[model samples]
Target: MTRIFPRPLTAAFAATAALSLAACAYNETLGRNQFLIVDDAALTQQSDAAWAEALRTQPTSRDAAANERVRRVGGRIVQAAGLTNRSWDYAVFVSNSPNAFVLPSGKIGVTTGLLGLVRNDDQLAAVLGHEVGHVVARHAAERYSTTALSSVAISGVQSVAGDYAKAAGAIGGLGAQLGVLLPFSRNHELEADRLGVDYMQRAGYRPSESIALWRIMAGQRQGSTPEFASTHPSDASRIAALEQYIASQGWS
Candidate 1:
C-alpha cells in the first residue's frame, strides 16, 4: 500500500527538515555545534517580553545598594564576555531563594538572597558571569530550536495518525518545561560555568572564589530539588570541574 502525503503537508515537512539541517552551526566560543533555527532577532524579542513579564509579575527589590551592586558586577562580566555591545539591564528580585538568571536580550535578574549570600565582589562576579555565559553561549536559542524541531517532528507523526493529538500530549508538561522554560542541560551548565570562570578571571576577579561560592551554596541546607534530577551538575562535580578548568588555564 502506498501512502501519499498531501502537497501542502509534504512541503511543510520539507521546509522543517531543511530548517533543522540548516540550524546546525558551529559556535566558536562554545567549541561545539548549536542547533539554532530561530534567529537572534526573534529570540531577543521573546527574551524582552519574558523579561518584562518577569518584572511585572515578580516582586522586585527596591534596595538601591543591591541593585547597584548587581549592575556594577554584571557590567564587568558583560564587558569581560565581550558582550558590551548590547545594553544590559539588571534587576534584583525580592526572593529568599539564591537564584539568578540572564536573558539573551541582556536582562539579568538576581534574587536578594543571592546578594546576601555572596561574601564579596568576586563571588558576585562569579554568579553574574555564569548567567552571562548562558547568554554568550546562546543556550536559550539552542534549547528553543531543539524543542521546536521536536514539536515539528511530532506534528508530522500526528498528520499520519488516524486522529490528531496535541503535541503537548506526546510530550508531557514536564518535558515541555524542560524543552522550553527551564534550566539548561547539565552540559550547558558546565559550559556556562567554564565560560563564567574565564570571564571572571579576565575581569580581574578571583577564579577560585567561584568555586568557593558553589561550596557555600552546597552547604546551605535548603529543601530543594537535587542536581541529579535537575538540569544542573551536582555541586561536587561542578566544583571539581571548575578546579580542573582553572588549573588547565593556569589562572590560579
Candidate 2:
C-alpha cells in the first residue's frame, strides 16, 4: 500500500496561518481594522499607469472653448469636494461616448459627448460632483483592494493544492465570480450620487440641477444604454437616490 502524506493538509493550514498574520499586519499599517486588504500606494501606481495608457490612446478635445468650460466646472467641483491632498488633473476627451470617469489618483476625464447633456454650469457641476465623489470616497482603491484580496486567496489555495492546472482553472472561475460583482459597482454609483449632490450644494450650485441632468441622461438612454451605465447608477435609480438624500439632509 502507498503511504499517505500530510503535505497538502500541512500546506493548507500554513497558508491559512500566513493569511491571518497578513491581515493583522495590514490592520496595523492602516491603523484600523478593515475587511478589505489593500496597499494604497500600490493602487495609486496602478491607477496612474492605467490613466497614462488611456491618455496616450484616447483623443482629447481640440475645441478650446469647450475644454475651458469643462476645466472651469471641474476645477470648482474638485475644490468643493475637498480633495486637496490628491493631485487633480482634469481633461476633456474628444470621444462621443458620453462618459466620464475619475481615476484613483484624481485624474478626471469627461467626454465631449456629455457636453450637450449638461445644460448649464450647475448641471455640469452636478456631473463633476458625482465623478469627484468617486475619488473622495476611495471607491477605486476599495475595488483594487478587493481584487488583491482575491488574488491572495487564490495564491493560498494554489500553494496548498500544488496543482498548477487546478489553480489556473480556479482562477478562471474566480474571474467569472468577480465579473458578477456589477451590483457592487452600482452601489458605489449610488453612494457617489448622494455625495455628489451634497458637494454641489456646498459649492453653491443648486442640487436640483442633478435631477435635471439625470432627466437629460434618461432621455438620451431611451434608445439604448448610456455608456455611463457601465460604471454609473441607472437614471431612475440615481434620481431617486439623490432626491432621497436631499430630502434626508434637508438641503434645499
Candidate 3:
C-alpha cells in the first residue's frame, strides 16, 4: 500500500521541520536548547492583551503608596537582572490573597495583600526577583513554544490519515491558553527561585530573605495541594533548594 501526501502539505512539513531544527537554539543564559518557533512580537502582543484584560476585569488599588513601592522595588530587581532594556509597568490589584505576577512585556501586577504580607523591603525584593527571573529565564516563552510545537505536530499528523491511528501525538499541551498567570512547571519554579535570589543578592538585598519568604508562603498554605500534584514546587522543597543555592554562592 502506498500513501501520498499533497505536494503543498509535503512542502509545508519540510519547511516547518527545517524551521524547527533551526529554532533549536542554545540559550547560554538558560544553559539549554530551546525550540522557539514563535517570534517575540506575537508574544508581546498576547502579553499586552492579557495585562490589559486583567486590569479591566480586576479591581485596582487606589493606594498610591502601594503602587510606588512596587515600582521602586521592581525597578531595582529589573536593573539587577540586567533587563533594563524595556520600560516596566506595575499595578496594584486589590485582593486579600497575597499574589503577584509578571508579564514578558515588563508589566507587573501585585495584590495589596502581598504588599502587606512582606515584612521588609528585602522580602519584597525576593518576590520581585522571582518574577523577574521568570522573565529573564524566558520560561513562559519556552513553555509556549513547546505547546505550540506540540500542537502543530499533532494537527499535522491528524490531517493525514485514518490508517495511522497508532500515531500518538497527545502529550497534553495546553491548547491556545496563552495567559501569563498560568503556573509554571516545578522545574521552572525552582529555576526562577534560584535566579530570584541571584538578582536580589546582586541588587544589595539579602538572599536568605528569599528562603524566608517561601517559608511564610508555606505557612500560609498549610494544607493545599500535595507537592507531587501541584504545578508549583512545594514551599519546603523550594526553600531547601534556595538555601542550598544561596549557600553555594556564598551569599546570605
Ranking by TM-score: 1, 3, 2
* Candidate 1 lDDT over residue span 20-115, tens digit each: 778889999988888898876678888899999999999998889889889888888899999988899999999999999988889999999999
TM-score of 1: 0.84
Query: Candidate 2 residues 132-227, lDDT tens each?
Result: 887766667666655555555555556556557496657745563445345557777887787788789888898888888889888876465553
Q: Candidate 3: give the clashing pairs.
A: none
lDDT of each: 0.85, 0.73, 0.81
User: Candidate 3, residues 27-46: lDDT per residue as tens digits?
Assistant: 78778887777666568989
Worst 10 residues of 2 by lDDT: 25-34
Question: What residue pairs are clashing in model 1?
Answer: none
Model 2 deviation from native, Cα RMSD in Å? 5.5
Best by TM-score: 1
lDDT of 1 at 158: 59
On lDDT, the candidate that comes out on top is: 1
Between candidates 1 and 3, the one scoring higher on lDDT is 1
State which candidate, 2 or 3, has the greater lDDT: 3
